[model samples]
Target: MTASTLSAHHVGITVNDLEELLAFYRDVLGLTVVDRFAVGGDAFADAVGVEEGRAEFAHLEAGGIRIELVEYDPEARGSPAAGLNQPGATHVGLAVDDLEAFYADLPESVSTISEPRTTESGTSILFLRDPESNLIEVLES
Candidate 1:
């Protein structure tokens, strides 16, 4: 039997601070906010493997891709290793038209691993951390 696999639904990032993450993704990164909702009660707790769980979710869209940012009341926090070589390390990749311009305008609150580096293939890549310290890989080709 053929394996059933559909296209990705969305990329979900668990965050401790919802407001700050929203501002970074929406205002700084220029993603559009599509929806916002709050979930809790029995079903939520069961699905999350927690005795009690409540969360606020914000959905943002960029380049036709959806990014779901969620904040839990109990505050689930984890940082994938500082380097990308670690197992289970994950990051969201984004593309920009002008990486230099974007970097120049970045606020001090934003943390960048380094300035954009252009590979021999003429593709520029940058690594940045969100307010929650989640990694985001940005490229311009």
Candidate 2:
């Protein structure tokens, strides 16, 4: 039987620094912080596939899509080794009104993977990384 009625609720990202990540999403990206809370326990650990899990979480919303940021205890955290060609690597793409202006306003701390470039199809895209090195793409709509 085929499962139906499935939809994305939010994208969860495990972060090393909660405040820094929150500032990037909320202040820099203009997402609204919906809520913040702490979570831990055997149930959560099992669900996350961690032997023991504990974290501070925040929910931010942008253009109706929600992003859940989780900052696990230092001992529980793992190193990030995701590369562009890696199987499990993931990136979020956002549509912007002014790609050039937005690119110009980006903080100096952001490492740009690619400057804004336009394709033959008239779509402009910019690729960059967050402080934690999460890849992000901004496209002109």
lDDT of 1 by residue, 1-141 (tens): 769978988999888889999999999899999999999999999999867889999999979789999988877555667677889888889989999998999998899999999989888999999977889999984
Best of the candidates, lDDT: 1
- Give the Å error, residue 137, model 1: 1.1
**In model 1, where do residues sit more than 4 Å from their true spots?**
1-5, 77-79
lDDT of 2 by residue, 122-141 (tens): 89999888789898889998
Candidate 2: worst-modelled 10 consecutive residues by lDDT:
73-82
Full-model lDDT for every candidate = 0.89, 0.86
TM-score of each: 0.89, 0.88
Which residue pairs clash within candidate 2? none
- Please state the error at residue 141 of candidate 1 in Å: 3.9
Error of 2 at 36 (Å): 0.8
